[model samples]
Structure formats: structure tokens, C-alpha cells
Target: MNYSHTTLTGDEGPQQQVTMFLTRHTKTTANAIDLIQGWSDFPLTQEGIEIARQFGRGLQGTRFAAAYCGTLTRHYETARIALDNSGNDNVEIRFEPGLREYNFGSFEGRDVSTTHQAVAEWLGYSTVEEARAARGPKFDLDVQDALYALDAENMLHTDLVPQDRAESADMVKQRMWQAMTNIGDLVSREGGGNVLVISSGTAIRQFLWTIDSEVDLTYLGNTAVTKVDYDKGTFSIEQPVGSMAYYERGAQ
Candidate 1:
């Protein structure tokens, strides 16, 4: 239950099995500023740099069989810093584009607070949730309200990030599942070993979604790692790494 030990090097070996250590990227300046960063490439803040170093140091002795990261600088830099600090400079870090974040089209780099206000005003709703609620039962929606929701959803996700592109949680889930399948293949081909994957909070939430369909992305611990073990067609979750909750497949 002591998941916050700050050391993972002890969980490595040539043990005829594959183990994945999934970590979220460190904090960013955009995060500190309450911006809807989405796929926008933001450089790491000074604290983010230090956090990466500390994370790497914590895993110093765990020699990874392979490492994976996304194309984003946030993910790449976090992995590089962690790997470099952990003396894993020799590990071939594989970059996979499929692991990128959900594109937050029109909202990229915009202040979430202001964006919410604008959305609320545009939809004739006092709040963003009111807008969403109106889109469902109990509240009547007008033609413009529907269009605003469509635009807002687009602004939440997309690669080119159109002026009015929004992404549903389900959309993110699909891509993340695809990435997992990709990682599973990579592990299977490598004959099983330890892996260190560096990705963003959104992608990480998708991974959590892969296991728990009811998981809320907003509630996931950003800096926490999630350890997953897969073998013999079975998957077991080891809670949120650094947290006291260690969950296995269903009830005992």
C-alpha cells in the first residue's frame, strides 16, 4: 500500500515478462496559468524540470528494457530528463505519434476561465455547465445553442485544432486504446521486459479509461504514475503509482 516510496528501480530484471511503468509528464507553465493547453506545445517550467529530474532519480537503478514517448516536447523532454537523470541515456526512446494529446482546437493557449465565460455568453447560458445541461433533457436548446456546443466540442479536441473543433472523451479513449494496443505489440515483440512510457495527462487519462470506463479525467492525479501488469490475457492495475490504492482485477 506504500505506493509513494519514490523508488522503482527495485522492480526490474530479465524475468521473462513485461512490466510497464506509465508516468505523466511534469507540470507546465500553461498549467500554472490555467490555460487550455491541449495539443499546444508549452515548454516546461523550472519546477517541471526539477520534477523530471527527481522522478528520474527515483528510478535510477531500474534498467528499462525499452522506453517510449510521444512526439510532443513536453513528453519528450520529461522522458529525456528522467532517463538522463536515471542513467538510462542508452535506452532507445521510441517516439510514437499516436500517443499525442487530444487537440484542443480553438481553445489552445486560451485562458480556460475566459473561454468558459465566452462560451457561456455565446450560448445565452449563465455557465458552461448550463449550456451543456441545456443540450440534454430538462432544458430546452435553441438552434444557436446546438451550434455553440458543436463548436465547443471541436475546440476541446482535433489535430489541426479548427476554429470550432471540440473532442469528446470517447474520442480520446479510442486513440488511447489504439496506443495501448501498439505498446502491447511492442512489448510482445521485444520478448517481454520492463518499459518506461512518458506521455501527457490526457493520454494518461485515456490509459486509465482503458482499464476503468467510469474514470473521470479531471480526478486523475497528474504527477502520479499508473502501473499495469498484463500477462496471459489478464491485466492487473497497481493503483495510481505513488498513491496508497493498489487495485487488482475485480473483487478478490
Candidate 2:
């Protein structure tokens, strides 16, 4: 849970496996400030922008052979800031929808701080924040639990992720696995190197789950880095979920 200013060394084995550096985006207005954000594009807050810059600085001299991100602005901006600051500023950032977050459905722009009791009444939660909280610390660690939670509220969206249904945790895992597998293959074919990925928390959680299903996918900090090793078409977690010096400059 304590993420220091560190990088995962990809020298763990022979040339068969590729090491990928996957990181959640720094705080968005929803994450660090206000408004519920799920698949919604919100620019990074002022503090978030600075944190991302620091995120880049934390890497210092580290190099990413290639970089990728989701189509959302938050994902791209975060990657731009961090990748550019990594001292290897020339890495072209690629956009891929496979790294996008779970669609929040009807809950996209709701105010998390107040006025959602009516909406939560049938959603199995007493407030909007309660439903939102279902993501991280409050997640039951069971895919069924996530399904139940999403089902309670996502019905309001006529065209939700699964057609009037909220996206299941297993669905997230599937998409993330495919995305990572594709990237891992590219890395292996091109020899091997660190591939930077800037994505959202929910997608990243599923990626981590693929590495270690027993791990509780929670507490992933803003800009936290999770490293995975892809070897001979197999993937393993190198670093599950860890942080850096985003809060305090000298901490990491």
C-alpha cells in the first residue's frame, strides 16, 4: 500500500517475457475533487495536473519503449504528462479503448456529496456515494457482488454497458486481459522492454486480478504503478498495486 518513488526492474528473466508498466491515472475532478466520473471525460484538476507532472518526475530516467492509453481525455492527459516528464519525452502515446473504465451508466454526472437518496432507494444503497464506494474499499471481492451492485442502478441507462445492464467485474477482466495480451505480444515480438500504460482504476483492477485473482482489487492510488511481466505468452504480476511521491515530493 505504501508506494515510494520506485520503478520495477524488468531484468527478472530471459527475453521471452515482456515487462509492462501499468498505472492508473492521477486524480480527476471526480477522484480528487467532485462529480461522479465513470467513462465520462473530465480534465485533470489543477492539483491532479501537478501530481501527474510529479508522477513523470518520479520516473526520472526510466524509459518506456512504448506507451498506450484509453480514448478518454483523462487517460491521455495523464499519460502525456507522465510520459513526457519521464525524461524520454518522445514515446508516442497510442489510444486504445481496451484500457477504458467501466461505464457507470446513469450515474455519470451525479453529485456525490448530496441529493441522491431517491435514486439509491431501489439501487440497494441509501446514497449515491454508497454506490460509488462499492468500487474500492467496499468491494466484496466477489464478481457476483460487483454484478449485484451494478445491476441495482445501471438499469436506468437504456443502453448501458451490457444493454440496460451494468458491466460485470468479469466483463472488465475479459476486456483488460485482451488488451494486455495484445500489448504483451507486441512487446515480446519487438524483443522486450517497459511499456507504459495509462488507464483508469476499474480496468487496472481487472488487469491486476488477471495476474493474481486472490488479490483484493482495492486501494489503488492515483498514479499508482502496477507492473506485470509477460513471458512466452504468459503474464504474471511483477508489482500488484503500488504508489509514488504524489502526496509528498520527497516521500517516493
Candidate 3:
């Protein structure tokens, strides 16, 4: 559980800096099922392998000091396969507990919709009826409303939930902050080189929030990669790193 770190590559000097390519793990069974996967270690689906291959194509020419991933099999396997396809044997893979997905306690490995429904019912509300009404054509209720309703319903179960099991959004943020700080310290102390981070979507979004609070984390597309520049103690968000527009198509 010692997930703290300092550097990934190069020597420490005045010219040293770190540029990170933040990426999420490719499609997985959890994703395909629309489940709440917090802390669950599910293997990737076949489609996930294909999606990860695409990500590897983006890293072909990009030099990395070292790469980091969570301890979960989905993340580690994706990193391994992607690096193999990229033919980048030089980049190291580091495993850290702080990089693991959010811990959701009893909610792990369960359908998100079912959990939402159960929580709503626990709160003494007829969620199915409400959902039906909300689903009416031209209702114009945004998806955010459903998310809020689900969150509120879950909150009502707070007393039934136990600590060391369920993780709140705030807790997830704090853990990610610690992990990134450790990575930053590494870059600050070790010098200049690219570092690729393979983490869960929410963890990556939390990093984005720390870098640019204005960016919408929930708005990112699936398996997206965002580039960030960190130099002289300042961080700036850049474009997605895996766009095909940047590189010619390689062998499929």
C-alpha cells in the first residue's frame, strides 16, 4: 500500500520536467455491463483488447520515461499489451495501490441501475414511477437529473453503509491527489521525460480537475487520452494524445 513515489526517468537537474499522458483503461466487462465497478478486479472483454491496441498505436513514437498503472488486472494487462504492441520495451511499468479505482464497498460488481433503484426504494420513493414520468418524450430532463437522483438515493443508505468499504467522491479525490503528488515529486526530483499513466476514468478525471478545474471530467469520451504539460511547477492541459489525426494509420 506504499503508493508514494518521486521520479520515473532521467537525472534531476534544472532542466528536468515532466509531461504526463493521462489515459483510462480500455473497455472492460464492467464497462460493457454498466456496473458500478469500484474496487472490483474484472478482466477485460475481447473488445477491450482491440480498444487497447488502438491506444498503443498512439504511443508508438511518444517516448516515455516510465509508465504507471493500478494493481488491478484490467489496468496492468492493458499496459502490458499496449506496450507490447507499441514495441516500447524501454518504458517501465510501476504498480501502486493509490492508483486503484474508487472503493464502493457492497456496491462493487453490481448493476448500476439496480443499485440506483434499490437505493431509491430504500428512501421511500417510487423511483420506477418517477423514472417512467421522467422518461416521457419531450420531458427534456437532462441525464444529470438521473445521476443526482441516484446519488441522493444512495445518500439515504449512508447509515447502512460502513467505513473501509464504501468510498465517497471526496475520498476518491483525496486518494488520487496523494498518488499524483507522489508522481509529481518524482518528476520534480528526477528530471525530464514523459510519464504515461493508465488509471480508471474517475481517477484520471480527478487529476484533470486538479490541473484545470474548469474542464468537465464527465464529458470525456470512452478510452480517451488527455495530455498535460508540467514544467517549473505549473500545469497546463492539452489535447487528447490518441487522435489518429496526429499519426498515419499503422498496421491494424
Residue ranges of candidate 1 with Cα displaced over 4 Å:
1-16, 116-149, 152-164, 214-222, 232-234, 241-252
lDDT of 1 by residue, 183-225 (tens): 6555745566777877776656666756765544343343456
Q: What is the lDDT of candidate 2?
A: 0.68
Clashes of each: 8, 3, 2
Instruction: Give the clashing residue pairs of candidate 1, or none.
Output: 105-161, 153-166, 154-165, 154-166, 155-165, 155-166, 156-166, 157-167
Rank list by TM-score: 2, 3, 1
lDDT of 1: 0.62
* TM-score for each predicted model, relative to the true structure: 0.70, 0.76, 0.73
Q: Per-residue lDDT for 1-252 in model 2, tens only?
A: 121212224543445567777888988878765565667888888988888888888787678888888878888888888877778689887777778877655556666453244434444676656755764443423433344365565544445554534466676778778888777766666667888888887678767876776765666788888788888778777643555543345236
Candidate 2, pairs of clashing residues: 3-243, 5-252, 17-231
Query: Residues 152-213, candidate 3, lDDT per residue (tens digit)?
Result: 45643544334535655566667776776667556666666787777887666666666666
Q: Model 3 scores what on Cα lDDT? A: 0.64
Sorting all predicted structures by lDDT, with the top scorer first, yields 2, 3, 1
RMSD of every candidate to native, in Å, equals 9.8, 7.3, 5.9
Which pairs clash in the backbone of model 3? Answer: 6-186, 7-186
